[model samples]
Target: MLCIKKPSVASSFEELIPKILTEGDLVETEFGERTKEIRNTIIEITNPKLKKVPEKYPLGEKAVEEYRKNLLYGSKNIFSYDYHERLFEYPYNEERINQIDYIIEKLNQQKNSRRAIAITWNPKIDIEVSKDERGSVPCLQFIEFLVRDNNLHMTVVFRSNDALLAYVANALGLISLGEYIAEKTNTQLKSYVHHSVSMHVYIDRDRDYIKKYFPEYLKYIE
Candidate 1:
């Protein structure tokens, strides 16, 4: 596993971009050729409060805010499988479960609880649909909230993540979610850990941009 520890999201993003571009292995996907890919990448943000968006990142504050809102709230039009819907209104056995509420209540009842987890991949729906038919499936798979020493820490797992295009915004949205949870649970927000099974950059799409902005790191790539 590749591990990256950073104090803030912006720093992590800065470090990760070059690492992925230089060290990632060439892989082919349904979309196209990707420049780099690292399996089982783990990113640990020691301080979730320092949520500065990198200046070079394409999205601005407003866009990040919208993404966070969509993540916490619901946006059916934006995503085929919205994270909010999966978390807040999970379907199972002809019933719906509000996982977010469950996590909050669990932590409130027992701060040391390890069972407070929310899962996005519903096998009933996710396994049945074909990727070609759906166009996009949920990349985020699991989320867990833990309260230790009066601080709330969040960990999320993704089956696949776009390291260059989507990681920064995704981290911001998750940090917002963690803050919301911390507020509800009355715990100070602390670390944010992100794990990705496949963290990749779309080379065919962003090669020029990488060459233009990160020319120095190109030496690491073959």
Candidate 2:
């Protein structure tokens, strides 16, 4: 039920942080976790307004472009893909699956299908207790897409989501995915619904920064 609608990334990121902080639960993550205090939460972008990104607001142009480049590929960058194993590294295996292509094909064939789910978490790979040394395991769990009334909407789920840095970018990244599929499916991009079990600002690291940023964003939201 925590949701916000913004016309651009520049405008949206500001709004998302506050929601995470407000709606988030003060929980602690498991051992080998990066930070101390965590906020487990959920967020929804009722309207992504991808139409205003880059060209219009641009936000942090250089940074956003770098991020955009990393995410645009069908391959992995700091993000994810490949039930195709597109990434050369990671668990260091060869088998793969193109989730993007799979979802696109599913929607192309059946517009009303609920079977359009693409998952990134592998129980064997992700839950390996011996692989504790690995730096990245995946915060993203899966993404589902639905088309209704000629509009394509996305539901994004995450096992652990970073509140400040990763929250907005993750939403934007998924929005990009939804946009791509919508174009292929010939539907309008409606919105993005985001659920993060851990949508938290790392309190020990970001408390001061988060507090400072809040009042400023508060005014903007007010």
* Model 1: pairs clashing at backbone N, Cα or C within 3 Å: 35-203
What are the per-residue Cα lDDT tens digits for candidate 2 across 1-222?
455555555465666566655554455555433342233344556667653443222133454444445655533433323322422122335555566777778888989889888776766666673266544566777788998887898887787766666655566766776787898899988877777765556655555555565644333222
lDDT string for model 1 (1-222, tens) is 689999998999888888887778888876556558899999999999898888867556777888899988887586557888898999898998999999999999999999999999887777765346545678999999989999998999999998877888899998999998899999988899999999988776876666776778666654
Candidate 1 backbone clash number: 1
lDDT, model 1:
0.85
Indicate the residue-level lDDT of 133 in model 1.
Answer: 56
Candidate 2 stretches with Cα past 4 Å from truth are: 1-16, 19-25, 31-40, 50-61, 74-94, 129-134, 215-222
| Each model's backbone clash number | 1, 5
